[model samples]
Target: MKFNFLAKEKNTVVNYENAVAFPLTPDYELYAAVVTTSLNASFYEKDTTRLERIKDLIQKSNPVFVAKLAVYARNEMHMRSVPLVLIVELAKIYSGDSLISKMITQVIQRADEITELLAYYQMANERNGVKKLNRLSKQIQKGLANSFNKFDEYQFAKYNRDGAVKLKDALFLVHLKAKDEAQQVLFNKIVNDALQTPYTWETELSKVGQLKYYNEAEKQKAFTQKWEELIDSNKIGYMALLRNLRNIVEANVSRYHISKVCDYLSNEKAVANSKQLPFRFLAAYRELKELNSKYVPMILDALEEAVMASAQNIKGFDVSTSVVIACDVSGSMQKNISPKSKIMLYDIGLMLGMLLQSRCKDVVSGMFGDRWKIINMPKRAILSNVNEYYKREGEVGYSTNGYLVLEDLIKRNEIVDKVMLFTDVQMWNSNMTKDSFAYSWNRYKAIAPNAKLYLFDLAGYGQTPINVEKNDVYLIAGWSDKVFDVLNALDDKNSALNYINRIEL
Candidate 1:
């Protein structure tokens, strides 16, 4: 199943032809790659062709891709780069239709960063011709009325004075440092209102009280008092509880509070209701455990339970096909997937392999680097299995021997319906030949002519091991579960290109 919209070229170069090969690349990976490259601009700043290729891909992407890109940029990449390039590319593709409007609305509703929200609004108002400034102002005003915070106040005043709007009622609820008489009046009113509000552990309102007092000693006293109250309450929101535990030392909270937080963090009902991805919980647990080994004893059981529950929620595919999941654990994969992330590409590959394994009934798993070996994946929690596989890093070696896996499978004469490789797609033979993957894949095709190769590119290096234009080969990039959506799209005769071309207005 070949997607008609993909590039027809057989080259490995990063050009416009190769750029559009995977338009459905996960939104998170696409933005992460672009932002990562942009931050390290010194390397690709002079490489206009590569940059333009990425921009071209963004411009030609479908609404679903564009919408997800907008959300990712505003949320995940908010504090990274300006996203001006992406915004420009989005303007070229988005026409402020109902779909794009809904996308913008979703972004605005979830965006918390002032700078990113402003940028989003500017894009909607200037490029897409959507009159959103007034709507956003009203939303901000209502938010301030319901739950006022220092951050919201700061943004409100900043944007208000910048001519975004000056809601007289909400403006008076915050304090501004501006010299304008009107601004001063609003700021003073906000300070007075904040001081009047009762300080408690109800929400973040106590933090607002501390901010309103504007005295270091008074703020510290209030914060400590609030922490004391919270400890006695013995109840905390799931996310806030995790955050508090993460910053236990700085929080200066009690061990009793820490214990209670851990209890909630591991609570089976809460964990099940959290709906967080198992991989994410595992990653957070690993970081927290490393930060303070003491946390391990308290939270490890809950983390494992959460992981198992999350695994139960995963819906496996009903495809009756034999599958091979090959993961790349080479030295190159040790580097973080993005500069802002601590997660390495190897972690992503492992997680993705586990996810695919969960969805497939007849699947064989293998890990390859300098050599290839068939892995007997244990039936256990996904995180535990991934950790066990990770512990064998030394045995797999550091070189990328991707072809060996296919070659070994061919030798075994295994009848495979599909072969999926989770990698950066930068495959090179031990002998330094570029055609190792291609050569081995060709040989496998001769034996299993109906088999298809799905390259799950974890890193968007913009190079593929095989010519993606080939009917038997497919390329998908990203670290999102939605990558599985490609499977449904593939079942159709037109592949993912049909959905991409649906032209939803």
Candidate 2:
């Protein structure tokens, strides 16, 4: 069967060691097993062989059997497994390892209210990182606090998993740049320690994981003492909060979960006495509507901005740049170095697609590997949280004939002036595209010889060099500040127009 990331939606849920949702007397052993298995990178990267060897030893009834499969696939990509990422994300969601997952809970709670809230949180957080605004906006971010991480007592704190952070608390702290692979590894260790130290799912985290850790349970508990604080702050649902947070970061967040949002709101209303005004009536009612209204449009804006920003030096182009975004939909594109990295890229695709459409309808968005078609309308809308605008879609393809897709688009008459291909740049020729470079560009030359190519290096999987100055192929690094600056700076029309008015129009 063709791998479709969107197809996994049917199985997603919360509060589980497995597929079960929030078991009241939850199986701690199951939770323990799932947690231990996910944290061990060696278990994920090189454990497939070990798992296969122990399959007979670790029966289906054995906790380790599932562990064997999940770990081997997760780190090693032994199974070339797409499901492993899902499992890890679920583990993080239910157990609460990362703050992003926690912040995203808002959207999960109310799919509709996600847009502006997420935008505000993200903007505030980003601004928090730099000395920009004279005053920081106080948008409460317990939004992610519902899926609170549980820290072990201080004696074992360094070896514990710290609880998740609030959206504002986690702001730009999510990323850390390093001078080299060693520093990167060091950074990862410190950051990981902070995330997992006080609450080790099953084991102690490395030194690098300590960079972002703090023991402030007193403050958090004191702050979230009442449920009213959670609701008023918009931290009502785990997924809803996380979705909003992700949207802010321009990370691919899940839909608002309209059905889930309504479900929660309905249940909350059910629990209240509404003879006059229901106790939680206003909160529940408003959250549902907000989830529905804000989600899609916010997503559209975030995606559009992200895609535009992910590209380099486009803000001031005197001419409108036409973009044909050709991406890889192969099963492997779902593969990620880490959960954050993968989510960020997926978010990047949507954000950019939306941005291109608004910035210029002249832009077209599509995915290809073995073949090509635009995600064009998500192909079909799947609303969640009464407010969701779109949902992730499942599609099919498995080869990188990006060269051909590009060539075909160029061969058409009313040509685009520029083509921005957001892909990993791993195009190997088959029986057809043996001379992809010549055939593709030659055809492009026939149509719009002046056209330029801007290669968006999503995740840096591309090994081929495209000299920006020489070939007009400007490349932007994924998950870097350059991604943001280039897109924002592309064209600042305000001051530019002010300069052109020799006499006012």
Candidate 3:
């Protein structure tokens, strides 16, 4: 049997290539590190110690920069793959080839405010629309307007060359007691070094976003080119983790013209939704994975990451609360997923209990078929038994009567703090179908007025029914961590907070 997707036959390389084992060595790190320091303008100001070290790191070809940069950028963007082609191209960002410098200076700064140019390029490629691409190209190149301080930026652009100095230092060396003329010479240098490459891809990217322009023949050629670039007989897996990550990411987009940079992807939202997702690739996975069915744990983890990264103000939330979770285990649940989804869900449910336990003391979880299970124990025990619980539950059918079942729990005059119900819509009532919405609403009110209702929808496929999207239901949309982050933040908010938002006269 084959292992994972490894490059097949090896290719011949000359003496220089022999030392190189993988597609890209650690040397790529130099440029990759730029993702972080890219906007640390102070680094670019003058020949500081840090700047010199970076130059040396790049000149010698170290990989740390790229590897760390990739990891950091992924966390920040919640993205996976970046196009290898664009990564290779980033090496050109400061090629000191005056022409390339003049062309790319604008795009680099934009990386701070916008995502890298490659994401737009990817959409353009996939969509095969030239107009949108042309628009993006112009937008990128337009940033160059800020570089008019010819002498200063010219000096910055060429700062790598010898005899570089700040304006004050340069004035002394040039023997120009007059600072103005010295500045003039510096300005002239910048204008003289400007690149000749004209901005022309605005239309190209626009075409990409729309995706309908490329002819059938051209599309085939583009597909073939992309596929060819990714495979190699060499199986060193030098950057295996990184490579797998990009593969997972780029697969989100179906179109080649709309290039989702293997490393940096640009999307419209601060956070992307899994169901009714914006990007084609994410939505495709949502369908392929039947995401709504079994993505709660993943979402929770993402939420944890996001919460952890956010302002510590989160620490002040009324986390002393607790909840009881009931997850459905109907016969329909026997539906296997991605080879390991069932087991994955079991594992996730166990892990989620732990995360919840960390924040609150009262937490109980159960998997119910015709019967209900009580998973109230320490984190480790639950994890150990979750896999077995799934095995025992294999091939079982489940029934759910949301109202009667939850009502059976002991009632308190005070509302329960939280109620977490995880179920696919497999057993929602039929006779009261029209009132299902009302039933769901009443269940929340009766079971736990003060408690928050969080339904981790696990059966959403193709698309969730419009009605299911009502409040309290969160659909996990992306595989990245962001989904969980949003959920946790949402869940962590106390009902009292919302009550505070509403003040009646």
Candidate 4:
């Protein structure tokens, strides 16, 4: 009496899309969840549920793997909050040794993260009511205490803001001993709130904001001058420059300063050191485009160059390898990555899709919702190509009918070497037919046996649209440009878990 037909596949699950798919292994799921999240609620999953899911995954995963994943997410992916969350959640379950402390030291790159880690620690442990710090995780405290040695007076003063757990509270909780007489003096200043105000972009902008202006024209003049000063001083960091480009342009800064800004924007070394995701340049470009300022073209050109710099390391296919890149433009994909962010999930898809398309010598790129349509595109102008796609997204209906891509390929009897789908992975059949992505992929495999499917999981909902293990499929997650490195690794027959495992703890 064999009942094997009724049994589901060993690693399969019904996803949020209500499609039969493979669940990521504990380590894979953890990596995907950490890299793709900012701890905000997604269209398909709430922040609380995602938090619980991560906690459960961390408990299921090995402690050392979790630690390395945190470092990888922070150092490689440039993620901020979730790495701290991973460490905090890991602390609650694993109490072996200096692993947690070492992780905190590795992940906390900025002075503010010290307080952020403490705040998250307080919230995660439900210790808000009990203010005594004696029961706090000693390893975390040791890590924070050691981290104190890395900052100076300006770094500490810049982040000493009042919160549920302030910097002063963290200093007290960690019981950090001063490293030297000078360090002891700095500690006193931190405790007494006597640290000097660090010169920064915010302070500079505030000074300009306070100047009395008699009229709109006068205010614009003042702002323009201030922006020029900020640009000349080099006090504004790269991220600050990107975020305030619109303000700088609207203020009508001089051509000298604008050119200076463009130079900084396009500098390969600066862009690399910024560690910003490629979509950030796209976001900045979109904002400037809406203004229709004369400088828009200049900034757009700079952004195009900047994005290419960010994607310089992406390993794409040559002419010998035919490629098709399909981006998901479903209604769900239109949801914002964060509540206040103008950038949506689909933006990441189009950005990454265009980036891949730029590298491929022979490629077919398009968007898919209820149907898949191929759009011929040039290899250059990566950001502008993304813009073109964003403007025409409505041409396709709003539904997560991703299987239509493979079905289209099968209908055309195409022998594409690589098929890339940049999507949220909540793919389902819009018409409720028996045909699914898995079915179409299987049929296409018969004709193109060497074909590979790469799913760029932007939303990281923790499910593949198809069973990755049973097919020639690779699941890559994260909104960072480093995610492309996973593609090259996969080409070498390596999995994402293997990529994370190779990270040195």
> Residue 432, candidate 3: how far off, in angstroms?
8.5
Relative to the true structure, candidate 2 reaches a TM of 0.38
* Residue pairs with backbone atoms closer than 3 Å in model 1 (clashes): 173-190, 174-190, 175-187
For model 2, how many clashes?
Answer: 75
CA lDDT scores, all candidates in order: 0.57, 0.36, 0.35, 0.86
Judge candidate 1 at residue 32 and give its lDDT: 35
TM-scores for every predicted model: 0.65, 0.38, 0.36, 0.95
lDDT of 3: 0.35
lDDT of 1 by residue, 139-239 (tens): 33333333232334444433333234234433342222445675465456544543223223444534546467757777666666677577666555555
- Candidate 3 global TM-score: 0.36
Listed per candidate, the RMSD to the true structure in angstroms reads 8.6, 22.0, 23.9, 1.9
Residue by residue across 285-381, what tens digits does model 4's lDDT show?
A: 9888889678888888998888887767787566698988999999989888888788899899999898888888878989999888888777779
Candidate 2 wrong stretches, greater than 4 Å: 1-225, 230-319, 337-347, 378-396, 465-468, 480-484, 487-505
Better of 1 and 2 by TM-score: 1
The window of 10 residues in a row where model 3 has the poorest summed lDDT is 12-21
Query: Which parts of model 4 are misplaced by more than 4 Å?
Result: 1-3, 9-11, 129-132, 213-218
Which residue window of length 10 is worst by lDDT in model 2? 16-25
Q: Could you give the candidate ranking by TM-score, starting with the highest?
A: 4, 1, 2, 3
Model 2, residue 87: C-alpha shift (Å): 33
Candidate closer to the true structure by lDDT (higher is better), 2 or 4: 4
Q: Quick one: best lDDT, which candidate? A: 4
